[model samples]
Target: MGRAHVSTHQSVGGRYRLVEITRRETNSVRWYADDLRTGRPCLVTRIGLPEEPDGAAHRAPARVLRTTESVARLCPGRIATVVDALDEDGSLWTVTAWIDGTPLGEVLAEQGTLNYVRAARIALELLDVLDAAHAEGITHGELSPGQVFVREGGPVVVTGYGLAGSTTAPRLTAPSYAAPEQARDERAGPAADLWALGALLYTMLEGRPPFRDRGRPEATLKGVDRLPLRTPVRAGPLARVVQGLLRKDPRERLTRQVVREVLTRVLSEDSGAVAEAVPSPRLRGGPALALRCADRRWSGRTTVLGTTLAVVTVTVAVLAATQSLPGTGSAADAPAASASAPGDRGASRPPAAPAPSPSGTADLPPGYRTYRAPEGFSLALPAGWQRLDTSRGADLAYRVTFGAEGDPRTLAVTYSTGVGSDAVAVWRDDVEPRLERSGDYERIGSIRSTTYQGREAADMEWYAEAGGSRVRTFGRGFLLGGGRGFSLRWTTPDAAWEDGASREALRTFLRTFRPAAG
Candidate 1:
């Protein structure tokens, strides 16, 4: 006979609120019940050798019930309402509270990029929850975009705890998002959550998994090992922050405090201003127009309604005066006799006075060519050119010169918050080492004493190969006291530098440098 089906419920002797049935290989069923009087749930499982009679299930179910009771006492949470060994029927069923919201992956696919500020805020909030979960000694075994729900408020992680910590059930798989240790079945810890966070950020920004693809596992592993990440052209500081988070080694990844600081900085109201300071593909359009109008003040232009009428009046008067004159060898030769005439005095009068100057008559400064840098140095630019103020961050000054063919030569000046000695030290300790390691630079002569805008300056020149092409780098450093300094660096390709006109223009610019107001 088929094993009898036994039912289990939350309350024993009361209507079976829930039911679980165990069918033995011997075709017998056993049922376990929860007594409503205690308002507690119990678990029952079938235990015995396959050859044993199905009736032996009673002992196994009792053991499971006792274990559940003990676990309940220790766990100190809601008691399991009901549990039952399934009939060797080879199927299992479980249910839990239903959750709402779309999957995070689906949401990201629909929205090209999340609101960065909002995303950062949410991440910070989630970190708080994660910290608590870690303290509870529970590692989210399956943390992935798919497992996270993007709700109206924020993300909610949904997973089965029993299945998560189970040894019998196959461990949850998230190869792409999982930490290296977690993938190897090693002890998963809080670090695994961080790894997943990195994967999540990468996926959001680049619209792809940070380290996974449809291929042989080994190939994917190799790709991950050699993953190359470049900041997207327009992605500002967020790109740098993401790169930090995605470091291959967990120890190298940003700490929670660092992450919070970065997020706070990127999400701040002034972040847009900071981002505007950086050159990026995203701001190439419209910014020029906005910049041009930034400081302009306009009042409505005056409209003269009598311009047409006035022109006609003047023409008529001139024709009449000319027509009345005698047609001699010259009108001037015949006009000497009209001094006594009544119209003579009026005719001799001068034309109406011209309009007055708005600022009154004054001699303006001669347009001499000059370059005005911040205190401590100066140079000269070619005549008839103007300095452009690029209102970026602390790297205060920038200017551009247009070539005959409409190409542009750009000059940038960066201020460093270090003294003269510190500035030289930085160059010697940091920049010089990097240049030497590049193996493409040749040191040129240095000028120990130079006069720039009437101030003392030091000049250095070097030639380097960049992108398989030779570039000339000329740098001048100025020391402003109180631990601050400024440097001007000019670079041009060898071909451009070889042009006579370009060379002369650069020389003129160097000679005309002057100090500008900070």
Candidate 2:
């Protein structure tokens, strides 16, 4: 058995001087203090202990120092470095290097809804640290916005590494983020951290946690464990990703690998400028969220701030931590002209506008509209069709698939900045090789070399089985000079391939397609 040391830090100047508080969670107060020994500003957190303290008080500080320092070594600069910890005057105090940033909770308190791209980027950073910690069997178990530092010009730094078993309290730091198992007082593992991640992500995008705080810690935990999540209207592409991670059963949550893949693709889809830092939260942003964590929580009057400024200003648009503009378009400003929200997948169609042909005349097809995408491309799509899924590849290549729900016909637009000059050889060599590997792929005819809108292009048609349905695909690849190219693949049930609607839609797409520059 290990002996635990319990002592009081007689401060106010003996070793450190309390400057000001930065955050307040359940039974905890985070202070910005000055270290008397080194004359350096640092952060000091105060957590209240039970009326009668015991051996646990001694273990809490030791665990915090040991766990934090150990994980900090593994992740290097990504985690907050704890300096000292002690128990004094019936409370626990943990000191750490001064972070020149604001807590994530504070940021949300001021900024209202953050940019979708920025949220994704932050989530990616958090996942990176959690991935490292989880690999070593270390569960943060106590992750919350309050434990995250959003510093300027640096990676997101995580705190509260060893707080899980440190206390027998639920929501000691953040109740809204507690996993179901944690709420139920059941043993939690890595999946619990993932669930908390989803809650944080949801909070950043929706301006509140998925489960509303109910004044008391136990009540909030009960709501979290029992209440169904309201559909988040503002998460955009990340809505599904958030829901997947928030599943009630820990066994069904998305694996770290899958979350990483989706988030990476989302990040890669943005332009090179997406590496910038997002604005931090205001220090005195209204009535801040009171200590929502701890064994016993107090109720505070919470007001939701609403700002009409949906899109970021021109300065922030060029920078990303991400802006989440449509199609991850970096160079183009988001046009207010979009009738539908960017990530909206609803089947209903907006009033149809005329299909603009390559000649710029709106006289081509009756049931089609020229959909101008923020990615700098335009094509005529059938009225009800909308962007269904987007995936990006290595070398800055991305594919956007579109179709209406309950419609078997789908069209995919792929763009790549790296391609050879010969379009025919591309389809026959690069493209055909992949198709051939698919078990059910069968070519319709020889690859045809063609000129599309005065550019060298190649067209290929093939049949493949998907979901037990035989489908015909018409693929057209065209070069836009300097190795950049776009490919359009339209697939329809084999039975409908020869119908007038299918033929007309294909013709409209090939005739009216425009590059980003166009």
Give the best candidate by lDDT: 2
lDDT (10s digit) by residue, model 1, range 228-306: 6545422334565566666666556655555555555654444544333333322221211110101111121211121
lDDT of each: 0.39, 0.63
In Å, residue 202's CA in model 2 sits off its true spot by 0.1
- lDDT comparing candidate 1 with the true structure: 0.39
Q: Candidates' TM-scores?
A: 0.34, 0.50
Q: Candidate 2 — number of clashing residue pairs?
A: 3
In candidate 2, residue 3 scores what lDDT? 7
Worst 10 residues of 2 by lDDT: 319-328
TM-score of 2: 0.50
Residue 460 Cα positional deviation in candidate 1, in Å, after optimal superposition: 71
